[model samples]
Target: MNFHLLRLASMALIVGTLAACSTAPVSTVDPSPIPELLPHGARAGQPAVTAAPATFAKSRWLPVTWSEVPGFDSDTLHEAWNAWLKNCERPTPAFAGLCSEVRRLSIANGDEQRAWMQAKLQPYRVEASNGNADGLLTAYYEPQLDAARQQGNGYNVPLYRLPAGFGTRKPWYSRQQIDTLPEAQAALAGRAIAWLRDPVDALVLHIQGSGRLRLVEPNGQVRLVRVAYAGTNDQPYKSVGRWLLDQNLVRDATWPGISAWIAANPARVNEMLWSNPRYVFFREEPLEGLDAQFGPKGALGVALTPGRSIAVDRQSIPYGTPVWLSTPGPTVALNRMVFAQDTGSAILGAVRADYFTGWGQEAGDIAGRLKQNLRLWAFWPRHLTPGSASN
Candidate 1:
């Protein structure tokens, strides 16, 4: 077994058991109310929701290295991925249809990844960071290159684009940077290697679910890859309790008893059982008696307002710090938002974030399209601390 799995399993069993016993349910409502946005220019309508006073406390900014994080071990991470996959449900007709397409593509060729992204995904026009016009969304459809081989193979992909000067330094990557700087070369090359080895795994856990990889052909042909996509799923624990109570599966259906019944379910044989929709997907964060909403694209785009979102993390990372994201997989670009407004279940951590693509079939299409690496680097007020709260 992967060492990480063993550790996480050991830890989770304890947490899971206790989680089943907790008196209070997890709160879904944003602890702090969503602040109303001031009109971009002037507005004739009444003022939008007023901004809440910043709740984040001051802390020294620390560069938390993701690769060094113990829980990020590949095998353990793989367990989580496989778990999510096995319990994956189509949140909408478009997503469900996309899943069918992905399954179909999977059947024709053993390459499930490519089938989902190419034949299955809906395409959109996009612009490169350099203002070059291109496909808005590019889905990577090939295996990643080994680290050592990436230096010689320049095949690369694009993920997402951020406003220029978004990070701490200006011109984050100069035109001649890759060829001129050894560090940049190593970083870029290391990225290529990581993606080729385990594109999906690398992207989801380590890279903030974003990044670019190279798909080099023996014939020396290369193409751009994109992996920005998302799908909806249940917040199992909360959902399970609600489901059971709603269906009269249990009496009272409180967190403790409901959780115990869930854990005790004969089918939950491994730690991966957490992925079961009964416990994973939630209608809301705190188990509010509300049904989860499905927007046209998905929740991320709704929360972030993609084109209109901005940074705002007062406690952990500063509100304006520019960030650089690195994920595992082939993508249209490298580097995306460190603090996008959109959010969801799987996306909850001080160091974690979600990039909204759109909703419904569009969102489902985007979710199906993802398979890459993502890295983040904060720009404004470079001197900020990481926070404890992740939501």
Candidate 2:
């Protein structure tokens, strides 16, 4: 049995408020731990922390040393990336540039691949582009798991796990490893440099917690997305979590124990937890008025993922810039992108953004009620348009 399944089974039988079911919250240890990907001690609790999309910071921009780029020759991983690209459709503007490059490198030998990589690096040989590429990219932060007994709004909310019977090899790449590989370093460094030095264009959005979503595709198809916020409301690894911990909202001192308590409670997870005031999620498809998903699960695909969507703002920002969102949370600063274009449902004017809240009741609740102002910055590649000049 999978690890989460065992917990789920035990939780299914429980019935009561989360607070009623657990003993007095225990103090946790290690008080704060470094996040999985970000720099050590970089968390959300501090106010006036250096602002991000950091696309303009020279300090974060580093040169890509030659040794840092990876060798694509005789490398299975490189070949796999090429293979994946072959399956994706072409002629779309997004892949046109990469597609051409792929074709040239497809039949090249080791020596040829090296030469090609060098040539590719010739034009704007620099490290880190911030986070902008021609296409788009989004960051998905795995939320903190709770293990306590305090039931509230998110009670009975269904938490979706990686589907059963699906096994795929997990790939782990260390920052050090990437730094040692020239090509990989160059590419990532280029993007990171791009993000850090440029203004944002696209802002892809995703949220943690349970809610319904509505995706209105270009072809007029609507899909549903849902997630359940069954754990404590505090966004761990964020400034919010730190504050909540200080405020006693996070009574459990340890992450593991806290998570165990949440799993045990199986109800009203969101009510007692810290939340993002800037974001308002829905219970069902906003358009359809459906019920929210129950239990401790969520669907990022259907809930936060947008469908064939594009956004545009003519005044304050330009078109075609990729945005890395540092959401209204405490922990991780880099979120997803919301593309920039010339059209949308409710998005209009400068500094205005319309996030694709997915489809359905949950979507309705979140999108319909969201009218408050939120802080967000843009990112772009310095090459495409210098960050300072663009902003």
Candidate 3:
């Protein structure tokens, strides 16, 4: 599992409460303006006066024309509309007014959407304060696993909910303590939301912060449910993959390599599990009808649209912002619009992002190996000054 952890509600509150500031150093480079792309029969209006470069806490935004964005004209805007609509659900003050028009344009053609964007939004090249445009991109996905309401047969590992008085302990019991200590066990007694067959799957669920469980109830009814991140044990997160790499136990530190090592050395499974001190707690959520089609609710408190949702550092890019992501990759090349509807502990930087691949095994496979070079462009409303939290 890639490090897309810590999509907790508390983190969302932090992002939501950041006061808008424009004190970071701005870039001095200026590219010549290019002609805007417009739909057929659309009249050319007076170009909006260009504004000075804006600065956020960790990033600098340099205004650029629509033509500068790679694959901007080619992307199917409607495909990303679902994510945009999700952003509208709890829109930042800057984007709240655009929701209605965004809703109306749900069925708009690519050309029309493109035209609308050009008319209403400004494209700004996102970069670090020191002016580096190149950055890294990783991917994360929801895992699906078979679970049971009660531990039995092969379902020996328990996925627990937050314990009573969990807040009293500054740092709750470590993973090993939770497994071995009677006191910790007592606190977690009767707290198993579901039981899984493999401890590795439990670890993956912990890392991904949410997953879909094909849960068999006590009554023998099997229903699909979602386990979402409620909180953590307040321990520091250490990567087991990094530990394996450091120990020289595995050449590939991805999930597959880790799984292979675990299979070969079954006795040391606990050793590997305990390498990461952090443990996540989850709460069960219903998965029914159209809800089943979406991924877990992100830190933005909205259902993440698989290919179009990305977890970004809120200091660099605010939640609910529309971002244009471009990456040339050995794993997968992408040049599309994605929404910044999630945040992660590991996703920290102006250009760094974690692409949300949809759930299941295939999504998991891609997410495990997807780390690529990336460039980003953020779209802001034409009327509002960039970095301001107002319409």
TM-score for each of the candidates: 0.24, 0.29, 0.87
**Which candidate do you rate higher for TM-score, 1 or 2?**
2
* lDDT (C-alpha, whole model) for all candidates: 0.27, 0.27, 0.77
Give candidates' CA RMSD values in order: 26.2, 21.9, 8.4
Candidate 2 segments exceeding 4 Å error:
1-65, 68-98, 107-111, 123-240, 249-255, 263-270, 274-391
The residue-by-residue lDDT of candidate 2 on 168-243, one tens digit each, is 3122222223324564344333121001110000000113233233333335465544333322211121222333
Residue lDDT tens for model 1, 1-391: 1001111111111222211001101121112211222222123443322221122342222222222211122121221122112212322222332345434443343234422332322211111233222111112111122222233333232122232223444334432343356764454442332223332222221112222233344555554332233211112222333445555555644334645665566463222222222210001111112111111112222222221222222333333222333333342232322223233333322343333332223332333334333333332211211221122
Q: What tens-digit string does per-residue lDDT give for candidate 3 at 1-391?
A: 1224553211111111110000100121122222242321232453543756889999998887676777787777887898899888888899998999999999989899899999999988888999888888877778889999999989999999999889999799999899999999999999999999998778778877888999999999999998988888989876776778778888866555667899999999999889888898989999998898788887787888877888888899888899998877666778889998888876789998888878887776666666778888899999998879832
- Backbone Cα, N, C clashes tallied per candidate: 79, 108, 0
Residue 193, model 2: lDDT of 7
- What does candidate 1 score in Cα RMSD to the true structure? 26.2
Q: Which whole-number lDDT from 0 to 100 does residue 100 have in model 3?
A: 99
**CA deviation > 4 Å runs, candidate 3:** 1-49
The alpha-carbon lDDT assigned to residue 181 of candidate 3 equals 96
Q: Pick the candidate with the highest TM-score.
A: 3
How many angstroms is residue 307 displaced in model 2 relative to the true structure, after the best TM-score fit? 23
Task: Tell me the lDDT of candidate 3.
Answer: 0.77
